[model samples]
Target: MAANKLYIGRKVRDLRQANRATQAQFAERLGISVSYLNQIENNQRPVSAGVLVALAEKFRIDLAELSGGEGDRLVSALSETLTDTLFDGYTPSLQELKLVTQNAPGFAHALIAAHRAYRHNSEQLASINDTLGRSLAAAETTPYEEVRDFFHFVDNYIGDLDMLAEALAAEIGIGDADPGPVLSGYLERHYGVRVARATQNDDLVRAYDPEARLLTLNPYLPAPTRHFQIALQIAQLHAEAVVDSVAAGAGFRTTEAYEICRIGLHNYFAGALLLPYRRFMAAAREVRHDLDLLAARFGASLEQVCHRLSTLQRPGQKGVPIFFARIDRAGNITKRHSATRLQFARFGAACPLWNAHQAFESPGRITRQLAETPDGARYLCLSMQVSRGGRGFRQPQQHYALALGCEVSYAENFIYADDMDLTNASAYDPIGISCRICERTQCASRAVPPLKGRLVIEHNMRRTIPYSIRPAGDAPQS
Candidate 1:
């Protein structure tokens, strides 16, 4: 077994040397005896509380920063390294790795560097995997296939079908008072289907019956969920052309991913048609994007509200180009959509400092954080957790967080920004979008360092922070 390494002494000695002061001079500045300072630097004496306070007060540095509570930086780096395909089948539990990072950064850094090297080697070996002779075709099979085939069966365009649905609902006197029966009636009238109560078997929420040409929804689904399903079914059938047109615009290589995206886009159009963009934008502006109120007014879910927020970019009358993202506890980005220039990692996961993951700890509570990337782009993020299904303790359902944000300058428009002290930038907690897209140099939350830079760790002369680096993909290295 390897022996435990003490980093405190090395860190203390480095800090003292960087000031270019003698041991006696440093001791005098710190108001500690020369012998005591020497003992602390040599690891013979632990940094006492008084000395720690004195250092913080003298240097005007937060204790958290000095003690490296910013250890999340190391975790971010480790996660990026571990995501390498070398650990494709084997992964240390997140809790275990997090503990190591918090208590043993040097070991974590060494392990991460090794893993990254292994991943690079593995990539070289697997280079041929991309060109393997395989059919690589879309089957046009299964539920997703059925959905896509149905869209292709019709041209991909649904003009005013949403309006038609609304008109029919109004004709039938279906207001918000009783949305379920009204929506069910609207679906039956439009699609020749009847909503039937079905058991939650096979984890299916809704299924289409070919014989009756009927859509059967799970009885356990909430009212909002049911409405979304019904609306989605209508759009799938009536708005196929619109969905296909959008999917075609994407120019995807595989039909499978394209089809999935098509369904989602179609659902989005359905929601938009239900609560047209103009009215939705008006409501959002009025409420200052209060997601709960918007959700209620539009009869949409929080996820739906956030998703709609991203789509507000409609040519000339664009609303704020806020980005919306959803992530699980493991920090995997399950869903992400952005209207702004913010680039998200298409191949990897998001940065750990993103508020989307933090919302899980506080659940339902909103958190605000300001993030600056190495490139100096700043963002203000707002996040809160939301849960779906599992109301009666069957599995307690899956709960995760949703984060919405815009550039820092545009943040004040949000209601949550009202009481926030944005004047003191330091008071705002620091965060990052994802390391791959973020270029912030000094961020402790950075994972793989920016894809555009090479970090050079100077062991002989350590700074107050961990490592420094030159921007990657910049001018040729001189």
Candidate 2:
């Protein structure tokens, strides 16, 4: 067996520089010679066990960072991006990507930033073309998508913020039965903010008064939304230090993306505080991952429960690795995060075959589907329809679908998977990221032809699945 290798020289160097210490001075703290420290910092030698301990003891560095947590995330994201057809034949090997991550993380990050810009611009052009009633060009990235990618690159897990929120939740005596009072108490005592429900404009859900120190929530808002708004406000005020610290280093290109990133992180902390990871995971297991039961237990709604389930990615103690997504009636993915290999499309709507889109037809009901991606991975998906803005007769409600799922291998962990025919290949519905990127040739529901493939015009025959595609290279079919 190969021995464990630790290459955290860059991180060590960063810590040393941050403290304004030279090699000799830092080496003295670690009880190492200056030459040895230089060798370690330059990656000529791996960080020794003794140096690792010294880092934690003297510098108070997080051991996890030294374990390549950030590097691993970068490698995963870069690997995913390389899978795009734009780089089809040029995808680098995993070991090569890891080398880039370890040696030049900045360069790796630069490459990702460039790709995001290209992707965003492409998506924007597509949106413009759609609005002008022209043929869809390509999908440009949204600020939401940019922030989503930022979170996705980090595996959607913010370790420091999550831990801090967990500790705060425990300190405030936040119980599962009624967490609202605990959250409200914390806001009142610490920030001098009073939480109350009041009449608001039809479009406005929450309003906060700075001078009066009042948080006014719409009474018509659902119980979950109201509680969530309170928790979100608490995060904005209390978790700003930690949230700002992370955001400062996240490499967001635009101001909008950066602001959205902060809001997303604050919301994440709120969910962590509301659910309180340890207790929620225990309840998840006890109930066999029943969404309804978990929601009731946590005094949350089903959507909140599903979102919380996806964020149970604490290192060493993780719950089911699920993906959560919210899609509007028009098929635009409003929100998404995946812990599994099934990546949502960054450009446009999800695959039409995904059960979440079908959820609109059966509002308020949970729908299940065993889905197989073009890559042959199978998932057990559970989707539910939800709505907002239905306060008055004239106010139109915006409907959406919430989906949660994981790989079929983890199917046994979810109650929704009990009745699924996991062993039957035919049971799984065929799905892909989007029509432009999907390589499926004979899909009946394919909205457009694959962007990188040849479309054969069959003037002689009629077929249920239009546009037979010959992608890149293959023998001509009769």
Give the top-scoring candidate (TM-score).
2
lDDT of 2: 0.80
Model 2 CA deviation exceeding 4 Å by range: 1-109, 119-142, 474-478
Writing each residue's lDDT as its tens digit, candidate 2 over 1-478 gives 5555676677788889999999999999999999999988877788877888888899776565466344655675566566556775464765577668877877887787678777756666757855676544334455776787788777778999999988988888775458778788889999999998786546778889989999988878777777889999999898999999898898776788889899899999988888888988999999999988888877788878888888887766777777899898888887777877677776556789989988988977899999999867799998989877748778788888999998998899888888777999999899987887786888898887765666787888879865577765455687
**How high is the CA lDDT of each candidate model?**
0.64, 0.80
Per-prediction count of colliding residue pairs? Answer: 13, 6
Per-residue CA lDDT of model 1 for 339-361, tens digit only, reads: 44344554367777666678988
Q: What is the lDDT of residue 13 in candidate 2?
A: 88
| Estimated TM-score for each candidate | 0.61, 0.77
**Candidate achieving the largest lDDT:** 2
